[model samples]
Target: MSSTPPVPPVVEGGPAGSAPGGSQSGHAEHKFEKWQMKKIPTMWSRTWAHRGKISFGLFLAYSGVNIYYARKQQVIRDTIPQNTILHWRITDGSIVETDTDKGYFQKILRATGGDSPSPVSSLIDVITTIKRAKDDPRIVGIMANFSTANNKTQQTKTLGLAQIQELRSAIQEFKEAKAKALGGEDKVSLIAYTDSFDNQTQYYLASAFDKVYMQPSGSIPLVGLSSTVPFFKTLLGRFGIQVRAEARREYKSMVSPFTETELPPPQKQNLFDLLKGLNSQILADIAKSRQRALGSDPVEKLNHLIQVGPFMGSEAKDEGLVDGLLYKRDCGKLVESNGAFGLAHYMRVTAKEHTNKLAKTGEPSLVVGIVYLIGGIKRGGGDFGANTVVKGIREAANDPTVDAVVLRIDSGGGDVVASDTIGDAIRWCQDEKKKPVVVSFGNTSASGGYFVSTHAKAIIAQPTTITGSIGVASLRPYFTPEFFKLIGVSVEQFFTGSSDTSLLHDLEGAALTRYKRQIDATYSDFIKRVADGRKMTIEQVENVAGGRVMNGKEALKAGLVDKLGGLSYAVRLAGDYGLEVHKNAGHLSSDMEIENIVVKVFPTPKPYLQQIVESMVGDEAVDMYVRDKIHSMIMRVWTGDMMGLLHEVGLSESSFQNAPVSERILDTLDTELNPDNSDIPDTVEVDEFDEIVSGVESVKSLEHDCDIRALCIVGYTRRKSQSNNCCMRGVEDRRLRMLFEQM
Candidate 1:
């Protein structure tokens, strides 16, 4: 949803191709801009038909080019002046609240002195920067851009209401802090600039700033929210792929695709309630912001404009929706007093993280550990490996330096067993260790995401965050004989032990009664967890459960979430809680040097190469991360938990057609997620007949240790040595030494 526009040189003219007064042919034309390489291989490499020689030549050429560009980017970053306005354009890549950083890749790059310049930024990083900007006297203001797009689609279309809520909270926090610092004299400016606002979420984010500016020809598509749930029942019938499953309650309709063609009453109600709740929050926020923008009844103005939306730039400006109609480059002059730069560049100059780096040396510190639980929940596969997540939590909680733990969650839920396991780990961290745990919700934290967060002392969510799908489902498949015959295949069943084997097939009569009882028990447990965590009654939780999703405001009203805020608010709370821990322990005094250190929890990726071996494939599905996630759901139909499975599965389907969206989503995060780390692990076993509680143990092999260096560098070492290749440990590789005097 986000992009990283290169550090473009500021020219005197308007946007790249536009004239001073660019005219639209009704509207601007949309063009697909795929990244294209500027240069093609030729000359010496081509003459040598041998593949080995060609590969070596290309590597050398690539190395030189990479070094040159990296050095140039570094030089530019180092030269940026203080008191500069940072142009923070929004992108999906940066909008995400990832659970883990690409540590494996980070290690390799650092070791080789190579550069892995990721344009994507984690949501916490952005929030922390905004918070710091309030106190940094040298920092002037933030120009939040929503118009980062190509000729065709706006990359920020993925910026949903939840993300906007997070951004809005951060902006509000910064503004409040700045207000206090200035003693009501003046304000630190926050300007929202964009060429167009096609999405409701974008508009909501822009509304948070002091002022909003739009392109002369830009339009605002302020239409309400809608959700689509396509049923594949008819399609499956046509293909003779009979799918039979059952849900615990009426609203648990995730398996409706395999059963019903039409929307069930409960599902319809659930979907509508979620959408309407989101829309209501959006309107309310805009109304509040606009009320402040205008002295009179601007809320009425907003209500009126919303009803007659999709307004053009001139119309929006006239209606008081936007402050001005100007090009993006033109906004630079508004904030440029001393000097200015992009936030990404500024971040690099400031060591790319918020730290007390400038504090006097040897200062006492209070460390806070930040553990991200991003993406769909899974048992040792996909991005959110169960083992990996648990290991991170344990390490962070046990670390003596870390006094508090912040679990930043941006998932939409998945595997029930996996989610519960993560939840258990959170509780273990809090109860076993003295660290106070806080959970921060991202754009979408529903079902399993909510499950994992139930045990935290505090939970923070954005006003528009998708939350509270308090439900459980078991969608084990029931294959009909005729369906198997159509595929020209047959499977014979042989059973021992229990006489009651009918439950393994489909739901009917006594079997269904037993199944219902099982699901009811699981759902009850889920409700109790939420109820206990949120300090609510079982009746209250049940009233909202029924697979109903709610926005952050609705969640707060229901007492499911403690606060309506973003990751920054959660971080601050964690710091406060940490200080309280220190204070309670009698280790703190008013004058004591107490600095809060923020560290990430991403120990290592669990068992990747084994999945590759099990699948017996190379990088075939490497580009299909989203497809893999969805496909995994299809395969997991036999294991129930359908509602949870599909909660976050839709994220990948949107961009799967153009290319591997998953690969891009995990940019530089293990090099296309390493085909070895393909999802679902090797086995998903239901331990001791506990179908709702599956187990996936970590599996590591020699093949999993395979990394980029092993493939690229000719002379490499697996063991840590005093002298190594790539000029690491003050020693260069033999190949490098031969090619160049010094590496």
Candidate 2:
């Protein structure tokens, strides 16, 4: 046992103005000494006090300078000076996370109290400057530095497969529109540039341009697509971890990554089929975009190109991948010399300047809201991928001018509860507000994503849209002694309650029965929700509810979707619905109320700190922590399934934010110690419901020990009743026998 250390005595000055180590009578000296001691803390306080003032002064000064520069830029842009070429620098990897709304800077200043302007704000200023230049006939051609703007993910996911197809279709529409706008299609010329053209998605977009240029050193990697599923079973097994999965269909390969060493035969076949279909589509698109006339031999030509070694930019030009090879500076020259005002210019001229433009534009007699649902469905109110779509719908419903809503869904779905909440919100908008809602599938909308869409009046899907996955799956793996056996470690859990032991392991005795019942109930609820939405019986829903994949076309035939069309079709339908409402209401209009102005004021991009933190703390840890805290607080009032229980223990392999403290602590220790071995247990048990079941089991055991006299008396009474009514006695005996058999 260590003893406590002695406390030091405090030293005091004798009198005011006297030095701490000097005579007691000098007041000035004492004051000076006192001031000296308080210097650091006092200085810190003063610095903080003046810091805001200094920052404000600097901010105002900067704003004044920016205003001066902006005015100058605008004047230069507007002056119809001849040979004034506009250079639109498009740097590679320059993706815009946010757009500048009109008067955004004023809003930003009011909210953030900062001098430095944001990127989006600067971009808006640039756009405004360019718009001013648009009227100047002397500004001949617009040159974009194409080295930037390589957003592969956004190009693929955000634009989506359907959107891309629509864009391609739009080109044909645009050609007709261009002829109407420019007198003829021949007057328009499009030019595009790139550094290296390895991005297939980017190349597809580039193909829309009349001419594409690349650097001499740049190479286009136009090889066929390949997808690899990394098997982690061996690694998990080495750590004595087992992944248990129960999926309804052979093609439900999402869990195969964790449980199996390699793809099962059924899963392999499914994967191959999917790959073949996807690759075929890709090949077809490439042939169409490239204008290659290989007929049925396009794949062979593509393979031949891949077999050739190191095809440079010039070679790509020869092969028709690009029109020419040029340096970065030459793009400006090309634009000034030969570039003509094309469809891109028209888009730039007419593109909606702000999100609110839809409402403000005078052309709209009746408003139809296009609620963009494009993210994950999470529990709480902030944006989570597709859940944002629901919020958009709610906003649309409240808008008086908005008579109808179109939910543009493009997601793989997320939390079940979130999906339910979103679906309920849509239903409320429809029933309470009497608004017509339509759901439009973009790329892939399935599971929870599809669940929300079921509430719509009509559902539309593109040909390639992946729509149906009418099932829910929960994965829970138990560690037990297997983990301890590998590490040569053991744990002893002690508790007073008979049910407490169940928490440390899988449910046993009464706990198992209760757990099974909970799963059945939750599953029943899931089925019922779908049944109600789709106008099917619960049993009918279950028949298709077992995790099976279906394409958009298949879903329509199965009554999962109402129509097969693109986003434009959905929008048109929404407009039609809105028009019907307008005609019925005699063109009555109302104002829409926007919520949480304070939150919207500073619509800053997600902070880097939060992104870093999320990356470090795995989803399992966060999910477990949230679930455990919620469970402790509302144990008595809980009504969900054992599926939620799996979430509490970090056993469920789903992405959520309720991480366990144990996991966080372990992560911290692992980082700090830098040990060769991790001390965390391979598995954790999460069955808090076991307690309720144990109590039930105890009651059942007591019933079994009832006195023989009591039993005999009951039997004698039953025999007398039987004598009075033979039919009743027979019915009672049958029921009793059934009950006894079940027990």
Candidate 3:
């Protein structure tokens, strides 16, 4: 330890090279340099000890600066230019409400260009964008791109007719706003372009614009509309399978497909009337839009033209269905020659300017809460998500800040109890919370959708929206022993109770009578709800409640809905009612108008982490999954995908969704045997029939109280062998568990 000698310390220098040790100048300098080098190494070593933390801190700082600059650039890019045209691309990705929540992964994915943008704008966004454009000086026009709305491959569905009408209404509003802004100059324009006008619906939407263009090779399939009902009685009879279903009234054609071999006269007439009404509306709208080109008798001319369709690009232009023929690139150049941006970009750039303006201005504002009740109204949840709608309504009603609520419905109905639960919540919201609730119908809000909204303060719908299916049907399949024998299968059952409603047993005798009584009670309850809500007599409600679907126009006349208008109109009504209530309660002055109404969506999307955690560790998640699967199966049945499956058993595919099913099946089978069709698979194995049924007898058992409204396509899957085995096992497990519980 004492092997080294002590070193002398350097003293402060009086001059450049002076040292306190009284040494030569060069020697002193060398000592000082040695000491400085030692000190520098010590400082560097201490700094290097925290290299990981230092790197991390530096990265965060760099990211902050990067984010600031990127946002600045995006703001500049999204800004509207002079005389700019906003583009609205209508595709299937369009959402009804604003999707405000984006997770960290979503943000990162978008930043890294891994996420593709939605091809279309939603209804609310589209309307809001137009409203903004109408006020902005820089925006001169809008161009709608509906090329992706309808696909020739039948892989994509067209936008709902009612949604198209809503868009049309917005466009009209935009035109009116422009005219007023220019003191009747009407300089602003709307232009529509598509690769091809694939159907009457696409062309119908295009006709709403000032000028319409299509690609040179495009064709307008403007053929007239035809509604086809698929009758399964004949096919089921061949297989010795029976379907027993009861309807509240004769007009409830939902059961006709199972009971009748062909469309009944009453249903056919009702369907014809609906078609005629819709066709008239279409002709009238087209005639009004094309008045300048059609001269006089425009509706008659349009009808004549439709009889001669489908028209090629040139033919359609000559017939005045379209204005010009041009490629998509040229069309884009023509529309956006001055400057342009997507409506989404415009919305993003201007959103900050519109956020809660009432709060900023210190003005008295009405807060309206919007709740979306979309898809089949199942008990746990619908197709929209895992959250029950009742919770959303209760939360909104209980919120002190929210003054009113608007329930936006876009469903074709589901379970009775689910609908009733939502309805009860609505009543409680109004009776207990004293908040006004308005309903806005979108596309097809019928049956259970209408049921839940029966007690709302007001109801609104688009003229083309399908609503008012108030009747109920209990449908079930009865499999005979002969059918089981044909399939080389037999099922044995032992039961002590006489109340069995299982699929393995037929619903007859006392059980069938009891089921009928339950159906009658539900129907009576439905009628009473409607009558009480509308302040109408039972006779009046019954006259319109025979399981009949009506357009908003008919619904208003029949007193089924309060008004025929879009969601915006409904929200305004809700705000007005809320303001009235405030005035009556002495909270607001009578002169205070409902200004700067703020609307918010309920049941906000959960955080990404929370969603993952809940999905991984909750019975709610499992229940939601099961309900979603059942709803999906029900949708497939109603939408005629089941008919496609039965096409394999000699049913004509043409009867299902108007496709040539028999030809497709023959072609698929021939592909295996014919060397020329080498592109297809070599064998038609069980797995090869991806969407086909393995066992038609397999059925999902619902809760005892839930009525069987329709046949659920149980065990539906895209992969036959594996999915069938898994589904069968699950069904067996559930059946055994239920049996044990019963014992």
Candidate 4:
């Protein structure tokens, strides 16, 4: 079935016509043909013979493409345009203490522009750019766009008033540098352009600039500030939920919302004082900034303006609140008449100039470490973890290269014990490691935040910073079974002991008495810490104690703070102190000057690949991903909605973001007081105060440190002997279980 061609057979000589000489010639010719076939090469053989040449060709192509990009980037770096206006669009989530602290996934998201990088600019970035521009001949002006600086919708990411003050301080520095450079009036213009001024804080920032322009359609709501507190006692009572709480003093209003239907007299007075102090600050700053424009009586004029109304663009211009009324595009044109570039672009182009200084030989360099502790202080790892902060400080302490540490803190406080943990670490860093630790308070470093900063070499806070609040409070909620019964959900209690310490039941009798004792001990410890650190008597500390929140100025006067300034001042002071240490040790000559002050931020940023891996599998990722899923499932099962789950768990969204950090801490502590695990040990040792210090050691870093002094009390009179009475033995057994379960 196949069509095939047959091969010709080889013959010994020429076929048919044969002479002996012809046969010999044919055989020679066949041998020659076989040799020729062996000499010629196939395509595969040729390619194999010249493999190096092909690889070289590929390498050259790659090198050429890389060279092209390198050269292109270099050109941009070399030739930044002259008379450039640096545009700073300070949008929501734009300001941070250190940009490099972001994790790898966040950087990649920013780099890819997938999430549209949120105009982020660190405090150092803005300050450095302005500082460098002050001397740069090419930079003629700075145009700040604050249209998105205070995003109302994204309240968590919005700029704080203290941050605004920090930026304004940088602007002030720029102006001073410009004046010194010109040896005359500052020629460089600092202009602020926004679509609108929504509040006094925004206007307060704009007031610092030489020229403030607003879109004609926009309005300036330069209204004063007001404080509001919501009481949930009546609302919770409707559901038969009662809160049992205690504060060391009356002014510790952290427990007020749960305990009272309305603001108590002490809380009302405390809030009023805070508002009054803050208002005085606002009035003073605005008056100073707009003094010339207001002619005489600037403070009086500002007070009248704030009281009268929020003004339209034209009205604001007329009232001297704004310099002009202009559209965003027109304002941009005016500022960028010569040339313009973004703050990022300018920094990129000039980075080589800054970096080259680092390479200079024979320069006296001072290394200062910067640690950002910016959130509610707690335990475990996060933005404001006591452990995380301790690690950063210890990293600086361990590093020979790090001469001093600058702790930049922005928090409203969280856990007292955790705060003390951080404070102890700071003490170790300074006293044991011989390092100077200076604190720079940001917007809201109060209570536990200040507690951690107590042992620092120096403390600096911006005039607008909210600080102080030196008192302790604790709250525990009890859910009545009667409420569940009313909702057709009967609850029953089953225990093999005489007592139950469950959150469902209220603490009373001995338990309540012991809780108050714990509060007193903590308050006394707080007072002692403050008195020792601030070099004040017990009475002096007590006067500023009692949970009274003060602005930076008042705190400085009260001796709670050493100075009133910003982060820059703190860094400088830290450097000076380091230099002083060196001088006293005979390391530096009196005539010698520091050529550079290098700020090394701690803890060093993690590698990019690690960041990526962590983003996927890290504890934070797991907590967020798994916890959200579990929360969602539970919400669906109960209410068929996921929104009110936080509220149901005794927390609202505001409690997470805006509540006194103690509120969140108390909520977490309430859970740890009574746990479901039953493998608890039968016996544990108690300390001299009848406190289980050993038990405290066994506790892992919690979200916040629970006040275990009272919670750790055993039921049998804190003795090791077995209880002979049956009821006492039962009580002892139950309390022992509660004690270890807390851990």
Model 4's alpha-carbon lDDT is 0.73
Residue 574 accuracy (lDDT) in model 2:
70
Residue ranges of candidate 3 with Cα displaced over 4 Å:
1-68, 95-121, 150-157, 183-186, 356-359, 382-387, 504-511, 610-743
Q: Which candidate is the best by TM-score?
A: 4
Best by lDDT: 4
Report backbone clashes per prediction: 11, 28, 0, 0
Candidate order by decreasing lDDT? 4, 3, 1, 2
Residue range 1-743, candidate 4, lDDT tens digits:
99888756545655754555787788799998987787665656888889899889989999999999999987876676887778777666677776643676766666574334445667766776777888887777788887755554332265677787887878877777776665654577788999987667778878888888998888888777788899999988888888998886878889999999887898789889888888878888888888877759988888888798889988888888888888888887776566778887677666666767677655667889988888777777764577678768877987888778999999998988788888988898888778899999988999899888887899999888999989898988888876786688877787786443677878888878777898899999999988999899999999989988889989999999998888877888898888888887798887676847777888766555445555668756744443344444432343332123344344444643454443433333323322463323334332122223322424523543333333233212222222232222222332332322332
Better of 1 and 3 by TM-score: 3
lDDT of 1 by residue, 1-743 (tens): 99998875543644665544454432343221111222224443456558787789899899999999999988876675666666787743445565232444433433453233225566666766676677766666678877653213212226556666777877877777766765551556678998887666778788888889999989988767766778887776765656656565677777777788877887887778877777777777787777755548775666677788888999888877889999977987787674667777666566543444636455556667777777888886444577667767876875767888888787888888999888988898888687889998888898889999988989999877888878887666555666778788877767785324542255668866787787888888898888898888989888888777788888888888999877777877888888887787888874454555564555434344323322433223532432344444433432342232223343222332233423322332222223375431222121221221111101112332322221111111111121222122111222122222211
lDDT tens digits, residues 1-743, model 3? 56877665646654444456555767789998999999988988988998899999999999999999999998789666888888877644343444432545444433453234353345666676777788888877888887755433222445677877877787887877777875673577688998887678878877888899998899988877778778889899888789889998767788899999876776677778778887888788889988887777898998888788899988888888788998888887776566888878788677766775544877767889988887788876433532357767866986789999998888989889888888888997899789999999988899988898899999999888888889898888888888889899988887787635766677878888888998999999999999999999999999888888778899999998998888878888999999899999999889988666777778655545544434455545644444444544543343454344344333343442233333333333344223494433222332223212212112212222111111112212212223233332222223222222232
- CA lDDT of each prediction against the hidden true structure: 0.65, 0.55, 0.71, 0.73
Q: Could you give me the TM-score of model 4 versus the true structure?
A: 0.75
Q: What are the models' TM-scores?
A: 0.65, 0.57, 0.74, 0.75
Model 4, stretches more than 4 Å misplaced? 1-59, 62-66, 108-118, 150-156, 183-186, 349-351, 493-501, 616-743
| Candidate 1, lDDT over the whole model | 0.65
The true-versus-predicted C-alpha distance at residue 398 of model 4, in Å, is 0.2
Q: What does candidate 2's lDDT look like per residue over 638-697, in tens digits? A: 234223433443334232123243233323333322246543222212221112222222
